[model samples]
Target: MKHLRFLNKYFYKYKWWIIPGVFFVIISNIFGVIPAQVIGHAFNLITENIQIYGLFSGFERREIIYDIFSYSLLYFGALVLVLYLLRGLFLFFMRQTIILMSRHIEYDMKNEIYAHYQELSLGFYRRNNTGDLMNRATEDVNRVRMYVGPAIMYAINTGVLFLLVIYAMFSVNTTLAIFCLLPLPVLVVIIYFVNTMINQKSEQIQEQLSKLSSFVQERFSGIRVIKSYVREPYTKKVFAEESEGYKQSAMSLVKVQALFYPTMLLLVGLSTILTIYVGGKQVINGSITPGNIAEFIVYVNQLTFPVSMLGWVTTLIQRASASQKRINEFLQLKPEIISGKQEKRAINGNIKFENVSFTYPDTGIKALRNVNFEIKQGQFVAIIGRTGSGKSTLANLIMRMYDVEAGRIIIDNTYLKELNLQDYRNQIGFVPQEVFLFSDTIKNNIAFGLDTVNDNEVEAAAKNAAVYNNIIDFELKFETMLGERGITLSGGQKQRVSIARALIKEPKILIFDDCLSAVDTRTEEEILNNLGRIMNNKTSILIAHRISTIKNADKILVLDDGQIIEEGTHNELLQKGGAYAEMYQNQLLEEESQSV
Candidate 1:
């Protein structure tokens, strides 16, 4: 129930419409109750031969019939008209308010969740599944809407209707009314047990459904690889198994629902029998009149109708409860990294790693161990290492993707954790190993970071990344649509476009995490040369596997097993005959052999 507290503000916000809706609901129900009373009164007047002596002493019997019939017709017409109008008004405002509230809540929830994702350390995403996150954002929010809108309104209506019917029954005969309500406690017990089961089963069904969706999404995204490897049949089998699990869970819920309605109907049928039998005996004994018995029957039926709807309403609430729990779990997750408490000043690109050590959350292995390094305001440094040698981990640390367990990272003489996260990240530009671009224009991609960059700046960045010529050759030039994840472009072209995106930011520190690995050596050299010409007096860190990529850097560090084994300029490392020299010689040998 606490999980549903997020909806309180929205419900209160729309109280203007809800208050009027409640008023109309009450008016409609009041009119609805009139028909039963009117019919009962008319039946008694005709059966007992009651005369209108006070109103018209001279009127004949035919005139009396005409007058009673006319009044009855008028009352019926007025009752119908009022009920119809009130119902229309209630529904109109209810729908408008519910839809608007759902939209606002969905929008706020998505934005808050997305913002939290951005603030979380990289380790959180690594541990969670992409499909699960999608489920939380889309399916879970919809469940909240169900509870807030239709479920709430129906519950209110049921309570009001039940109370009004009970009061009407008591006015007719209190003893008979008490006997008719005997099955209510039993019905309540059954509903409570069913609601518990429904909540549990609903959770299982939702979880299985998420797995099915995830399996389909992952298979479609990786279809190219699957086809190349001739594993389509195997993939299909896996998907079928996941789909079967979802089916079984859904069937379990169906079985419970199958029992729910019939059980409610049985209880209602028994209650109706008791009302008819007891009321019939009372009328025979002349303890109550036939007109009173007729009205009591109508009220009893009214009570049963709302009681039956309570079962369906309970089922909806159970489903919503399950979904609320899932959504609450996601919202409750605290990010590993915390943003600054105070405002941050501008950065000056001085980076220092003071004996920092880090271990990824939920894993015991150390990624960086007692590492120390420093870079001044303006220098080009390259970090060269083998796979799993912690080069990318070093880059991630400087960007504050994950905080260090021991020691501090300082930028411009201030600890990284003490600075505002959004402000700190704004000062650094990064091109990741895997490039991701939205399905938008090339010009928009290049100008992504800057809110007010001109076309000239976009062109300059593209030219520096050596991708401007390619864009010009396109049919729509920079305005051309790239398709999903930039699927329309070649691998090298995508990397260059991503590079252009990072370069457009004009940050004080630039980091490239093997972004040029896909391009041919000649094209790579051209982009590197362009970068060197434009990156005047700015700190740059390049992570690359090829020796040629980083040979001209002011300093280079060779890493292995999370430790820096060699640190020097390219010429000095070659002279030392250490690990860096060995790697360089091996690369040279491989190239010579390929040429031969």
Candidate 2:
């Protein structure tokens, strides 16, 4: 009933079509009931030995036969014509209604799911499979559309037909009608049990299918790495196992379906046989006329179709229920980060972190502990740390990807939480460690967020990032199409493009998280020098492992185990012989030895 309610609103919008379609359906069914009357009346006319009237009522016996033939042809022809025309009309509207309903539901569902994704914290995406989200957005929504479109209409039609046949049978002969329906109660019970089993099995099948989709997506995306590591056989073996599980689950569902259809057929057939035998006896005993018996038999057969369709409807409902449950569960997930109910705040990039502590949602392990930092307006600050030292976590906090457990982060003298997230983030730009680009032209990627920007500004940003020459080398230049994830570009080119994209935003606060790692030392130096000039008065945060990357910064912070151990200029840190001093000495020795 809850799922049905979900479809009601959309159904109402197209009720005009449905109402007419249903009226046509009823007209077709009424016409279908006529053939039985014709059969019974012809029998009576023959048995009674009556002088059947001709077309004019005063005609020869040959004319009488011809009249009967013509009347019979007209009766049958009218039934066929009405049924064909009305059914075709109804079918057209029904298809249109279904398409309209499915498209509306799909559009709404996709937007709702995407909105939820946008609200959810980064932790949710990190723990969940990308393919699973894709399936929920695409496959699950489609399944729900199937239910809304075809399943609902079929359910309605089946119910109408079942009741029509039952009423017709009762009107003809009550005793025989009751006897014909004796198997119905038992059949209902059996169908209920089968439907329950089907729902359970179908849910499992869909879950396994989701897993299979995820496996395929993961493998395909990482195929390069798998081949590079020479793990083809191992990956194949894992995928084979997942595929086999999906196959086995599907077969299990098939087995249940096979049993259900046969049971339905047997029940319907038995009811039909009962109607024939009992009604035949009634006719011979004069309890009812031959015509009545003939009509009863026709009605009984009519009932068979709806009964048989019950199995298919049950299967559809089961699949729909499974899909609905998955979609509901996804919608119910609460994002780890919550948006505040306040007006948008104007930012000038004065950031201060006071006693911040953080933990990942999945593991609840502390990623940062009592970390404190501050950057005055328009300052160039660098963060240096070993791997897993919570350097990225700090950046994530500043970006508000995850909320801190205990602390306050202030931006431009306002609490971070008391600002509209989208508007606040619009003032900041981040270039992550691993750059990702959409499969679009280079120009669009650079000006992604903005609605409109001149080509001159885009060119300027590209030149500042030192990738203008590379872009011009290609035939399409800025209009060149990059393959998926920027696969057409080398690693260094992709990184520089990402940098240009972030820089073009002209954000007040710019973050480069290991963005220079992929380029050669000379290239890295050139980019750093260019960035220094571009960021003269703009607030910037540089995260890197190399001392040279942070050498020109106003201040550098050395982090170890989530806490800042040292903070000073590069020369000041080297003179102290601390953690920063030790790292600098090692890199200096390595560089000198390589040069020799």
Candidate 3:
């Protein structure tokens, strides 16, 4: 019922097209059955007139036959031509309306799903697999469209054909109709069992396909690691296992379909044979005219078509139902994150974390616990911590990526949740450790977040990030197209491009989350110098492991185990000789060793 309601919205939106298309199905089937009656009547007229002319004495039989039947033959031919032409036109309208409506609905559905994905929080994506989502968006959508267009159209056509043919059959002789339809109960029993099997097999096939797709996508995304570790054979083996699973599921579905179609065709043949035997006896006993027997045979042939098509239509319905269920699961999901009613257009970036603590979903361990910090507007604050010390987690909380499990983070005296999500995020520029670049021109990537791009502003941002010279060295300069995830560029270059992306936003708050770790020391120093100038009136938070990057900051925070053990100027932290001093000394020794 839920699935039906979800699909019904689309049907109702395009009801104009669907209703007329269905009406034409009825018209075409009515016209279709008329031909059967016309042919039977013509055959009877020819045979009966021959017997009547045999009693003529003054005229030759041949002359009487030609004179009596030539007009009727011409009339029969003309009537057939007109009827068939109208039927063909109706079929064209049905296809144009219903098939096109299905296509439109598919387009609308894909867009809606994509929009919904954007609305979903990061936690939703974390819980779902990319390839599985892709399968639901694409393959499942196509299957539903097939149900709407070809499956529904054919089902209706078959139904109308059966109804009109059965009426025509009963009109000629009720006893013959009863005998012809005797195989229906046996066919219904077989179809009921067959449909159940098909439904189960279809669901298995779809699940196996999603798993195979996810396996391939994950393997491809980590191809670099696989090759580095020489795990090609192992990866291939796993892929083969998944592929075999998909193949087995598909064969199960095929097996059900194979049994169902043949069984239906056999039953249709039985019904036709019975109709012929029963109608022949009625003609011999003079209970019905020969013309009526001829018409009954035509109706039997018409009925056979729908019965045989029943299995295929059932298969389509089962597949569509399964697809609808999957898509509805996505559609029904409400995002865990919701925006606040407050609309703050300008944020001063006075951030204060008051006893904030957070734990990731499905994990009992806390990533951050009772962390406290405060940064005044336009202050240069740097956070230094070891791996897994919650440095990144703190940054994530500042950006409202996830709400803290306990306590609250405040910005400019307002709680983080109290500000509008979009308006709040727009005021900050964030560059993370893992830089992602799209497969587009460099200029486009830098200006991606903006509605319009000014070439000069992009170049200036690139210069500020100390990568302007690198851009000009390329043949295409700013127009150079990047490969997937900027694979064509070096790590340092990708990081610089990401920096430029954040810089162009010209945000009130700038965050660098170990973004310069890949760049050479000389380039990193130059970028920091330019960033220092840019951070004059904007609150800047630098999260890094290297002490040299944040040594000159106005204030430094040393975090260990989600607690801030020390907070002071860089020189003050060194004077205290705590975790911050040890990290700085270790990095200095490692650099000296590398130089030697």
Candidate 4:
């Protein structure tokens, strides 16, 4: 309930719908209870003239008495039928208002959560799995919907019906009403305990479901790796184990749930028996008519359905609270990377890393150490490093994916964090080392960032990336749809398509982070030459290991173990004969041996 307080705003927002729904429930219950009293009156009339239907004792006046009795009974049945019809009509209206309001609330809640997810930083994603995130947004939200809809509706209906039935019973005979209701107090105490157990079990079930969903999602996403390793049987056995765990967790809840219906029926049956037995005594004492006994019985049965719904509604409320608590966990999180100065701002391609250092938050790995460099407008710079040498870290900082733990980065003579984050990123074209493409047409994949792009621009970018021939060779060409992460294409083709996506943006700063690793040397040379032609006057930073990829850069920096060991042009590095020269010589030998 504390966690569910977050929904107060939505409840207030849809109050008009709720107000009318409550009215309909009250009116509907009024109709629902009236029929029982009508049935009681008809029973009394029948008792008054039980022998009126006889052909001898009342036979002389049988025709007139029969017509009168038949009409009276018909009128009573018609009244009951009318009452029920009205009850059903208002019930329909009640559902229309309340259930529809719940749907609206569900829509608003999901959108709010999705927007919050978008605002969160990459660290949030790193800490949470997609399946768990999805479960919170989808499954948890749906459970909360049940509380807002059916549980709330039935709760109101039960309260209203209980009051009407109890008042009717008390007016006839208080002693009988009191005696009949004795079991209800005991039922309430049992329900309190059941609700406590339900809340605990519901939380456990939700947690287990999240784990299972995550396991399935991860396994399917990495199915290619699993197949490569030939771990199919092993994965299947693990999946079976996970399924059994889920079953056990589910059965625990189901066991508790199974207690509800029988308990409700037992309490209701006890109330019914007391109503009949106690009312018989009252009739014997001349305190009430036979008709009053019939009325009490009808009223008790009228309470039966609502009484049964008590356990069900309580169960829904418990589950909803548990789910809302989970949802609140993520909603309460403040985004770590806050955007500063939202007014539109742009960069002029001048970037300086002044003693920049950073550590990955998730692993606490220091990937950079006192990195300092300067790249002016229109300069082509390349960074070369061994694996884990902080080349990508530098790129990430430039992109502002993560802020430096120490030192400050200046972009265009301003602090990187001070500028508008969205505007700053928009001016830079960054192709990460690992390529990703959406399951979409090739043209749409290349033209993703922009609001709209013409076909010529898409084709020209593809040609510049040297993937135009490959795309056109396909049956659907640019219109071809890809599988997830572009699995429909080869590795080299996917990399080239990703390059085309960045190139099409025509950004002021182009950072290609080892994007050409999958293509052959000849194709890489072709792509680089195309870049050289179009990339004039644009700040291009190429991070790669191969010398051929960075040999033509205006300046080259070599990194070793998170620090830059050498910085020079290609000729100056050869003269120094340091790490850069050593790498160039080794790569040349490998190429020569391959040719031989």
Candidate 5:
């Protein structure tokens, strides 16, 4: 319930729905109980007339008495029909209010959770699985909706019906009422303990269901791999095992649920039996009329459905509590990354790292150690390094994905953290080693960096990336849609499309983190030639392993083991004849031998 308390604000926010809904609940119950009273009076009318007609059997007008009794009964029947109709009408209104409010709250809850997910840092995503996040937003929110809607509605209905029915019974005959209600307290105690079991089992079911969903989601995401590796049998066996576990958990909950209705009806039946027995004695002793017995029975039966809903409503609420607790786990978390409040400013891409050091938070690997570098605006800088030489780490720091631990980064003389985060990222175009594209049209994918774009601009960027010819060869051209992660395109095509996405922004700084590896050397040279023409006035940083790619860079930095070992123009490093020169001579030999 402490976790369930998170929804209290929603209850307050939608109070209008609740207040009107409560009014209708009370009104509907009032109308519902009135019919029982009418039936009682109608019974008494029939009995009294039966006595009259019998006494007047010697009279010549007994047929007239029969007609009078028939008319009176017909009127009472119509009145009872109208009463039930009114009750049903109010019930509809009750649903319109309370149930409708629950849907609104569901919409709000999902958006709130999704927005929170967006604000969370990369570490948060790394720590939690995608399926778990999705389940909390969707399935868990649905459970909470049940508590706010149907469970609350039924609980209110039961309470109001009990009050009205009990009052009517006691008013008629206190002794019969006392005896009739004796079975109810025992019913409560039994349901209380049963509900405890229900709560535990329901929580277990929810947990297992999350796990099952995660398993299925992960399998589908890697379906291609599973099929390619011919491991379908293995995956199928694991899926079957997970499904069996889920079924067992569900059946356990169902078994507990199965106990609810029968036990509920049985106790209600006992109350009915008590009513007839005690009520018959009262009638024989001249304490009440036979009509009073009829009325009491009607009242008890009126309470029957509401009382039966006890277990179901309790089960819904219990499950909802379990779900809300899971949701609160994420809702209560403060995002590790908070955006700066600084206003947006123009970026000139003069980046300097002073005494910078960083370690991966999750892996605990020191990626950069006391690194210092400076890149002036509009300079083409290239970083060449081995596989683990911290090339990608430098690019990530420039993008401010993670804050520096030891030293500060300055962008155009402003502390990197002091600049607005969103604004800062918007001015830079980054193409990572692993390119990711959305499942959308080529035009949209190329123009994704901008809020609004035209076909001409998309084409221009595509041409700049040397992918325009490939795109135009398609029958649908720019309108061609892609599959998941742009799977419809070849590896080289995907890389070019990603490059077009970054290029369309006309950013102040462009960082290519070995994105040209997928393309042939000729295509790479063509794309780099376009970059030289288009990005002549903007800072460009290209990270690659090929010495040929960085031969013409204004400044080349060679990194090894998280530290820069050499920095100079290609010709200057050649003069030094150290690590850079040795690598250059090796690649030259490899290329010359391949030509032979």
Candidate 6:
């Protein structure tokens, strides 16, 4: 009951529907027991008027007995018929209203989970896998729905029917009724223990499912790498092992159910035996009529189904309990990144990193050490750093992907933390080295950042990125749908499209974090040449390894081992004979060698 406390709000939300549904459940079950009582009375009526159906038509017959038997049989038939009608009607409403409400609640829960996921910081995504999250949203949500819908409905049905049948049994013969109900407490104890085991097993099974889902998702996403390495046999073996673990968990649950249901059935069967023996003796001893024995038997038989159903309903409840616990654990997590309450104001893109030092979560290594730099509005600054020298980390900080651990990042003379996060991010455009595109039309992908797509703006952005000519060469042009992550396009084409996506935003500050690495030097130069006009009067930060890409920028900062080693123009760095000069020489030599 405590585990189900999370669903209190949903129950309150749908109480109008749920209350009527529960009412129907009670009505249906109440009607359900009427048939058994009617059958018993019909038997008693026949017994009372045994001579009414005499063999000879001319035999002396009691007219009143004949009329009473005929009328009683007709009335009993009509009573049973009407009860069936009411039972069916209420059952329909119970299932239609309650089960559908559960589905609606499921929809709301999934949406809520997804909405919360969007609000969580990037660090959370780094710690969790997509498949595990998917399992919680889909399979776990479905299990919760079972608890809210069928398990609740059936539990109520069992309770109502049990009470009605018990009263009916006592009315037939109190002693027999008491004796027949003696085994129910033992059945309850058995159910409680079995339910505990089932819950533990269900948790294990759900965990295994998450692992298997993660494995399949990761493998499929990297199938090309696996195929290129010819590792299918090894991957298949790993999948088979995971599948076996899942099967073992499932079998454990099945084994518990296999034992539990039969035990319940056996107890119910014993209760029926008790009723037959006790009632038969009472009849034989003249303490009750033969009709009383028949009626008691019918009442005890009606008790069998609800008693046996206890095990199944218990399984639903425990499974839902286990799933709800998992979901609540995720829901309880509060995001580390909190947005500011300030309203968005105009930004001039005067960015400054003042003595910034940062370290990643769960790692002792400082990714950036007292990094100090500033770019005035409309300044073109290039950061050239070796691999692992914290260039991307700087861009990520500026994007507000992670906060600096020890220092302040100021934008437009205000601390970055004080600005509204969404509004701040909306003013900046970013293109990362690894590009990802949705499976949508080329036009839609380019215009994805905009609230509304303007065809003219999209085409201009594509042209500025130098991918427009190649796009128009296709038969469908901008309307063509891309494959997953734009796999159908070449590497350079994909990067250009990503650039176009950023350019369409017309952001005040544009950070290109080695996004042109895949393009050839010629196309890279052409795209940069076109960007000169678009970048006018706007601040731009170019992070790259190629000296040619940033040689013409207003300023260049060379980084090494998380510290800036050189800061000057291209010719100034060459004259100083520092790290940038050496890198330029090596790159020139590599190019000269490649030509030969």
Candidate of highest TM-score: 4
* Residue runs of model 1 more than 4 Å from their true location after superposition: 45-78, 98-103
lDDT of 6 by residue, 481-545 (tens): 99988987999999999999998998999999999999998999988887777878889999999
Candidate 1 accuracy as lDDT = 0.81
Clashes of 5: 0
Local error of candidate 6 at residue 40 (angstroms): 1.3
Q: Write the per-residue lDDT of candidate 2 for residues 448-556, one digit (tens) a residue.
A: 8677999998998888888899999999999999998899999999999999998888888999888888888887887778788877788999999988888889989
lDDT of 5 by residue, 120-199 (tens): 87778887888888988999999999999999999999999999998989998899999889988998898889878888
Could you give candidate 4's per-residue lDDT for residues 1-596 as a string of tens digits?
88889999999999999999999999999999888889989999998866556644635677778789989999999999999999999999999999999999999999999999998988899999999999999999999999999999999999999998899889889999998899999888989898999999999989988998999999998999999999999999998998888899889888887987788889889988998899999899999988888888888888889988988999899999999999999999998777768577656798898888889999998898998889998899999989999999889888888888999999889888888888888888889999999999999999997889999999999999999999999999999999998999999999999999999999989999998889998999999898887788889999998999899999999999888899989999999999999999999999999899
Q: Which clashing pairs does model 1 show?
A: none
Q: Estimate each model's TM-score.
A: 0.93, 0.94, 0.96, 0.97, 0.95, 0.96
Candidate 2 pairs with clashing backbones: none
Higher TM-score: candidate 2 or 6?
A: 6
Report the Cα lDDT for candidate 3: 0.87
For model 2, the local distance difference test gives: 0.82
- How far in Å is the alpha carbon of 499 misplaced in model 1? 0.4
Ranking by lDDT: 4, 5, 6, 3, 2, 1
Given candidate 6, what's the lDDT at residue 501?
Answer: 94
Runs off by more than 4 Å, candidate 4 = 51-58
Residue 29 accuracy (lDDT) in model 6: 82
Misplaced by over 4 Å in model 3 are 53-61
**How far in Å is the alpha carbon of 27 misplaced in model 5?**
1.1
Note the Cα lDDT for every prediction shown: 0.81, 0.82, 0.87, 0.92, 0.91, 0.88
Q: Is candidate 1 or candidate 5 better by TM-score?
A: 5
